[model samples]
Every structure is written in C-alpha cells, then in structure tokens.
Target: MEIKDLSGMRKDYVSEDFSEKSLLADPYLQFDKWFAEASLVEEFEANAMVLSTSGSDNRPSSRVVLLKKYSKDGFVFFTNYLSRKGREIDENPWCSLLFFWPHRVRQVRVEGVAEKIVYEDSLEYFKSRPVISQASSSLSLQSSILEDKERFDKMIESLVSSGEDIKMPPHWGGYIVKPERFEFWQGGTGRSHDRFRYDLEEDHSWRISRLYP
Candidate 1:
C-alpha cells in the first residue's frame, strides 16, 4: 500500500460561524442543542463518542464508544467493569468524552469524573438490552485470559444449554461522567477553527468563554 499524506489537502468553504454568544450560558443546554442539530443533519453514529481514560500507571488511553445518555448532571454509558476501560476508570475516575460530527464541521470535548451508576440503575438498563447481549455478558468474563475461540464458544453453549436465568454479571455496570468542563469546536479553513470553552465553578455555575483557534 502506498502512503499518501492527506494532511496537506485543504478545502475551501465559506460557511457556518460560531462564537461565544452563539452558545447558551449553560454548556449542557448548548450541548443538547448541538446534539439535536447534528442528529437531524448528520447520517453517521451521532451518539458515538471517543472515551478517554488513564490507567493506574497514569498512562493515557482512548477508544470510541457509544454515548448512552446525558443530562444536566452527567453522561452515562455501560460496560463490563473488569475490562481495560473499566479497570482504568476504577483506578482513576477522571475521564473525557469527545464527539465529532464531521459533516457539520463540529466537535465537542467533555471532561469529568466517572462514577458507577446505582446497582438498580445498572440492572434496569441491563434488562432492557437484547436477550442475546445479556447472555453474552453472563457467559463472558471480561478481561480474563482465554485459550481459543473453541473454548469461548463452548462456554457460551454450555450456558445456553443450562437454560437458567442469565443474571447480570457483577462486573458489568454503568458509569456516569459528570462533566466539569466542555470545549466546543467548529472547523474553519486556514486552521482558524472556532473554539469555545465552558468551565464549571465551585458554585455549580459555568463560565463560558471563547478560546484561540
């Protein structure tokens, strides 16, 4: 395969404008507004976000994951608590979520602490998942070493044959990311991208300001 650097490829477009005042005083409201607008016009995974975490060793890591829910208080997503991301979260609760809607030339970055959802909350959402997914969760020991595909499939089949109630894996749970800061970016040509940042204060109020591109 030939490697071609597309970084130099530039596009010219005279389009949308974003500024400090263009956003709401409440960053959460502004996020909701942008989310709705993007959902209406963009075709890709609107709810997907790049989640970032730090391990016990303080090394940084990130991966794309679906955004499950959000509110004025926090954002919620589910995963196996024993997985890599989960272990990272357990060791260091702080995390960040990034959302990009390329078609709309917009991106949002959120930073916060991650906390486990209530057991009942986790149970409710777990039960709402597809039956097959529930079964997989029960059969899988997330982050555990496995021998091969044969062993994995056999475990799943054994669980299926038992025909017992598939209890929620104790290691499976949901985490809420209570955002302390949010940065909004709207792309512009010549690297003059529009950017705004909203930081939360101790009073639970937000301070919104425009940032250098």
Candidate 2:
C-alpha cells in the first residue's frame, strides 16, 4: 500500500458578498432565500443535504437525503424507519443537516432535533413518488447487508412489471428536523469567508450573530 497526497488541488471561490445587515431576522427565511438561489444554479439535486445522526454508541453517520419539504416548522426527508438513520433518530432525536452548494460557494449548517411526521403526510409523499421508486423503497431494507443486489434488482423489476399497487411500508416515513441553531457560510476571496450563526432563544425568537471567518 502507498500513501497518496494531492495537496496541490485547490480552487478560489468568487461569490456575491454576504453581511449581517443583509441577513433576515428569521433563519428559516434566510434559508429559503439561499435555497432558492441554489436551485437556480445547481445543475443537479439542489435540495440534497447531508443528514448526520448518532445512536447510543455515539458514533456518527452521515448520508445525503433529499429535502422533500421545509418551512418554519422544520426540514423534512423520507426514509425507512428501520434503516440505520431512522433507528438512530429514534434512539437520539438530536441530529444535524448540512447543505452545500459548490456552484454558489455557500453552505448552511443546521443543528436540530428530528421527529417523525404524521403518517398521513408520509403517505402523501410516498404516493407522489414514481412507481419504480415506490417499489424500490418498499423492497429495500436500507442500510442492511445485500448479499445479492442482482436478485434484488430482479425482484424490483418483477414487482413493477406485475403492475401491483405498492403501498407505503409501515417502517417507511418522513422525519422533520426542528433546528435549534443554524450557521450560514459564504465562501469569499482569499479565504476571508463570511459566516453567521442563528440560535433559538427562550422566547422562541432567533438571535443572529456573525462569526469570524
């Protein structure tokens, strides 16, 4: 085995300036603005975010999940309740969501508590997904070992060809993450980036502060 080093790789970030005065009083509103901007420039899934969760062992795990919905209430994404991330959220509700848009040289960090959304809400989204996707989710035992991916794929194909209506699995649902803190970062020239932190106060108001970057 040989150690590989590619420290020479680098790129400069050039984006519109961001400042405290331009910040929105509500973090959710601020997120909405940035999210909209990212949607315009991102060629791929702009709603994708990294969801990090930890269970009883204190070991952290992160995976990209698409942002299905969001509002002042929280951010929502769906997955199998029996999956590793879902199980972790059940054991420890605290979690974090990170959104990075390289095209915009911006990212947002969200620290929050995750809770399962109502079954009706989950069912609605589940039904809206494409039939193939519905079949896949219904069949997959996410995060579990797959000894035969070919067989699984065949099963999915057969299920779809059968024209059977796929029902949302009992273990599949959505989780809403209520953010307690948010940090918005904008990459700047010469690494003099801009960062701001928003924390929820006792009165349910958000306190915004700038961070040294």
Candidate 3:
C-alpha cells in the first residue's frame, strides 16, 4: 500500500450555533441536556471521555474511560486504584475530562478535583457487570506488565469454572470529579465555533462567558 498525502484532510463544520440564551443557568443541567441528545445517536460511544491527569512530576497523560454516571454533584468512573492514572490522581487530585461528539459537532471540557467514591458504590457497580468482566477485573493487575497471556487466560477460566461468587477487587473503585469549570463548544460555519465557559463563583453561582473561536 502506498502512503497517502495527509495534508488535504479536513472537514468544514456548519452546525447550528450555540447561544447563551439556550444555555442552562446550571452548567450541570446544560451538560445533561447535551448528553441526552448525544445518547440518542447509536453510532458512537456517547459516554466515552478522555481523562487527562498530571502527577507530582508534572508529566501529563491521557486515556479514554467510559463515564458511568453524572449528576449535579459530579461525574463518576471506575478504575483500579493501583493503575497509573489512579496513582496520578492520588498525587494530584486535579484533572480534566474531554468529551467530543463529532456527529453532533460538539465537545465538553471539564476541569475538576477527583475523589474516590465509597467502596459500597464500587461493589454495587461491580456486581452489575457481566461475569466475564468480573473475572477479568478480578484476575488482571491493571497497569502491570503481563508476561504470559496463556496464564492470564487460564486464571480467568479457572475463576469462571469455579462457580464462586466474584467480588470486586479491593483495589478497584470509582472516582467522582467535582467540576470547578466547564467549557461547551459547538462547531459553526467557516470554522467559527461557538464557545462558552462556566466558572464556579464564590457565591456558588456559575459565571458564564463566551469566547471567540
């Protein structure tokens, strides 16, 4: 196969404009409205989001994680506590989450502090997962080097065959991100996108502002 030139690749966004009047006074409610709309389409993983974190060394990393829940309080996702991202969050609680829905020509950026949810919550979600997923989560040590795939597979098989109740690993749980800032972006004609940012005020209200794009 010949390598193709990539310079010409581009798409012009000509979606409807997002205006302040259409925004909810509460940023959380605004997010819910957009998420609800995105959830209606079947093409993409509407709940998938890019979580970015920085450790004490100031080096940053990003990975895609599925958003399990969201509400006025915060956004929630699950992970192994000993994973790289988990360790990074331990060192620095502050992180950012990015969600992009190209089909809708929209994106949401969230900045916040992450805090672990109660263990009971994690257990509840774990129990709701498929048995195979439970086995994988129970057997695999996330972020650790695996020397043998066959061994891992055998372990999972053993767990499945044993017919024992699979429990949530002690190292696995959920984190809730309490957002302090949110930026909502909508693509527009001629590359002129509409952007709005909401910053939490001391008075517990959101101060919304528009940015040139």
* Highest lDDT model number: 2
TM-score (C-alpha) between model 2 and the true structure: 0.97
lDDT of 1 by residue, 1-213 (tens): 999889998776445777665768888988999999889988887999999999889999988888888998699998899988999998999999999998888999999999999999999988897766787887777778876879878777777677777789888989999999999998886668888899999998888888887
Candidate 2 lDDT over residue span 1-213, tens digit each: 798788988899895779877888889999999999999999989999999999999999999999999998999999999999988998999999999999999999999999999999999999999999999999999999999999999999999999988989999999999999999999999999999999999999999889998
Model 3 lDDT on a 0 to 1 scale: 0.93
Clash count, predicted structure 2: 0
| Prediction 1 TM-score vs. true | 0.90
Instruction: Give the range of the ten consecutive residues with the poorest summed lDDT in model 1.
Output: 12-21
Checking candidate 2 for backbone clashes, the offending pairs are: none
For all candidates in order, the CA lDDT equals 0.88, 0.95, 0.93
Question: How many clashing pairs in candidate 3?
Answer: 0
The candidate maximizing TM-score is 2
* Residue 158, candidate 2: alpha-carbon lDDT: 95
Give the higher-TM-score candidate: 1 or 3: 3
Worst 10 residues of 2 by lDDT: 15-24
How does model 1 fare in lDDT? 0.88
lDDT of 2: 0.95
